[model samples]
Target chain A: MLNIIWPVFIIISFMYAIVTGRVNEVNNGIFEAVSDAVELSITFLGTICLWNGIMEIVKKTTLIQKLTKLLNPLVKVLFPDLKHSQKAKEEISMNMVANLLGLGNAATPLGLKAMKTMQEENCKKDTLSNAMAMFIVLNTASLQLIPTNVIAIRTSLNSANPTQIILPVWGATIIAAVVGVLATKLITKKIK
Target chain B: MVNYISAAAIPFIILGIIIYGLIEKNKVYDSFLEGAKEGIEIVFKMFPTLVGIFLAVGALRSSGVIELIVKIVEPMTKMLSIPSEIMPLALLRPISGSASMAVAVDIMKNYGVDTFVGLITSTIMGSTETTFYTIAIYTSAVGIKKTRGILVAALLADFAGMIASVIIWRIMSTSFC
Candidate 1:
């Protein structure tokens, strides 16, 4: 999907620029994009490293176990099929916790682990099961308590109140999660 | 008051993790270094993806596609009380995080960082995931060929988040003011 969409963006942009006589602007934009990516990545590195370090320390403790226990019931409700799979439960819990803390980079491995674990239980290895669909929806729309990346960008931009969007982000993500879960449930039932 | 508390929360979380690591008798500093090293690697890994997406997004914006989109969607946005300036960010957000981040930064640079458009763009960025990217990586990780309803559900969630960001920002801005 992205493979097609990405190239289309470039082509359309070139076409539009030529027609609009903004070819010079497009050339400049393309040239500037490389540095923009480098700068953004570097800016993200310090914060990513800091939070990831803290997460690593947290991982060495029994915090994950406690979090797993705390989130067990909700996980059970969301991933009912995984109720019997201890490994799946742990991976899912860890993924959710990382996501909620806005540790997206950390969450990817855990999410993949959860997906692989769920795949092991699926009768059809190639096709997505209902459980996998639910997991994807939840992971994609994961409710974040702190939008650390956004806050970091705001701070870097010298915004007076970098964390001011915290409440709005929390509210918005909660809505997304709810809507995502509900849609998953509805769609899965209809398909079955 | 809430801002102060939320701002303090990051430090509190760091302290909590360190104290927990101490009680657990873990080698906190070593583990931190290991994780930090992994963090650096992750940043490097994202470089190519970021560059590709940014180039595309940059072209799209500079070539007048964004303005074209804004013109087309301006009425609907105004009806919903969302500023048209943020329309491109909302559109590109689900597709690419780096692209959307660049747009958000552009918005902040043009409009004041404290402006409603800037705040809402930041909120939207925070609230939504990169849906297509997440779907692609996740489905491929498990070798799932058929995604079924995942795409629809994820896109719906992204839409809901976008709307919610605008609504929440509008309600909260009054309090902040």
Candidate 2:
């Protein structure tokens, strides 16, 4: 189904451009795109550097362990086949925690590490294990409660109530998380 | 007992991310640089494609091509009974995140950010990512030559999120009272 549609869509969008004579308009767009990415990448790199230090302090204090233990039961439900391991619980907990706080910057490394850990535990290379894929879907869905980016945009735009976005963000995240989990679970169960 | 356990780990969880990145600082820098470099490369790669598409769309928008399309789409609007207010999102959401953000922001400012409209806008923003940007970046980074089903899956999920946001916003705004 997708194999056919996506290529066609791309071709159509491209053809639309060529037909409209906008193909020549790309030099500026290219420069703009590269500049935007470079700027964003630098900021993200710095963010990870700073956030890593904070994560270390938390680890030394056993904060991560505690959170891992707390989320284990729900993790069990979400990844039913996952063995109850101290490590697995920690990775999933860490990923979910980073996401909840709206720190995708933090969540990603955790998500990647969790996948590696899951892959090692499950012993699969050709396909994603149930747990890893579930986590991926959830992380990508991004259960943001405070929505820092949106708030920042609002503030910069001179919004009267930047903080007012919190509840709506929460609603979106919670629903997306639930739907994402459910859909992933159904698909995983059916396929594998 | 459970809340107690996780709450305590908040500080440490953050710490781990920091230390992980730092301990592998070299790897992190290399990857970051690679992404930066690749980003530039991608700009060049996607430029020819993006500009052509953008100009066509821009002209469609500026030259009233879209307005005609909108008229064509008006019957569906009536059929679904969608508000005239959200018609722009139907057009704007797929192609340009910033444009939709502008539209959403305008709504928020005029109607009050605390209102239902504001909530819907924020919900939509939070729920769906910049789909094309994410897809292109992630797929290119992974070196997936053909991203087969992923694109459709992602956009479908985004569309679903948009619908859900509207419905949920409507419910929250009304049901609470």
Candidate 3:
């Protein structure tokens, strides 16, 4: 997917800029983009380490199992074939918890962990499993409870009610998630 | 109260996890160090993908391509009663997180945050995910090359979120104000 989109982005940008005489702007954008990515990586480093560390401790105790138990019904529905992959189920549960808490930093690392575990016993090397596809859809739909970052930005901008959008956001995400799950399930069945 | 809860959430979760680990007689410190090391490795592995995505997204944004697309889609969006101010945002939200945030912030600055546009922007920002970034990282980390169905489903979901945001906020702004 990225293999196609990434190149198309570069090609179209250059083509459009050349046609529209915005070549310099495109050049500057490309030049500064790597540094921007590096800066973001640096910012993510501390938070990622902190959350990963905490998650490790959680894994060591029974907390992971408890959390997994709490999320079991949802996880089972999402990845029913993962009945034997207990580790994958646990990581998926952890990732879901992190996402619901609106912890983007924590969620990525936990999600990567989930993906790694799911890949451990895969017979296919390059193709995604049904469970993996469903998991990615769940992440993409983003069923976050409290959008802390959005509220913070609104507060900074002096909004009268920074949290007023929460209810609407919940409505949007729930609908998005349902659509995503249905779409994935449809595609999975059709493909199989 | 919302602000207070958001601020305290992380600290409370961390403290609770630590105390639980201690009660379980687990090697919390050692486990943390190990996990932290893995985090560093994961970041390094993701760096190349990040750079590629950021470069493409940056170029796309700066080339006026999005504005061009918005202009093309203006009539359709207008018919749907979606504001033109948020078209770029709807386009960028799934591509890049920071770009969408910048656009959302710009919208709020131009129009007050309580306005319909601002409200919809915030709702969209909160609900939608960066589908490209998340899918790329997750699939690449696991060495999954055939990401055929995932991208389609994810982008569809983002579209749903964007439309849902606009409709909900429209109803909300009308009823509340």
TM-score of each: 0.85, 0.58, 0.68
Candidate 3's docking class is: acceptable
Tens digits of per-residue lDDT, candidate 3, B58-151, equal 7877898867777888899989888887886787788877656655765676578888889899999999989999999999998999875778
Each prediction's fraction of true contacts recovered:
0.78, 0.11, 0.80
Residue A53 deviation, candidate 2, in Å? Answer: 14
Best by lDDT: 1
Give one digit per residue, the lDDT tens place, for model 2 in A1-192. Answer: 324533553455445546766544443433444454344334333333443334333333444455657777788888876775667767888877766655554566776667666766664454556676566566556565446556544554455555555655556656656666666666776665
Task: Give the higher-lDDT candidate: 1 or 3.
Answer: 1
Better of 2 and 3 by TM-score: 3
Cα-based lDDT at residue A78, candidate 1: 87
Compose the digit string of candidate 2's lDDT tens values, residues B47-160.
Answer: 443343343334344334345556887787667644344555544554555555545544554456666666677667766665565445433432334333344444555656
What TM-score does structure 1 among the candidates reach? 0.85
For candidate 1, lDDT tens digit of each residue in B7-60? 777778789879889998999999999888877886677678778877887898
Better of 1 and 2 by TM-score: 1
* True-vs-predicted CA distance for residue A140, candidate 3, Å: 0.9
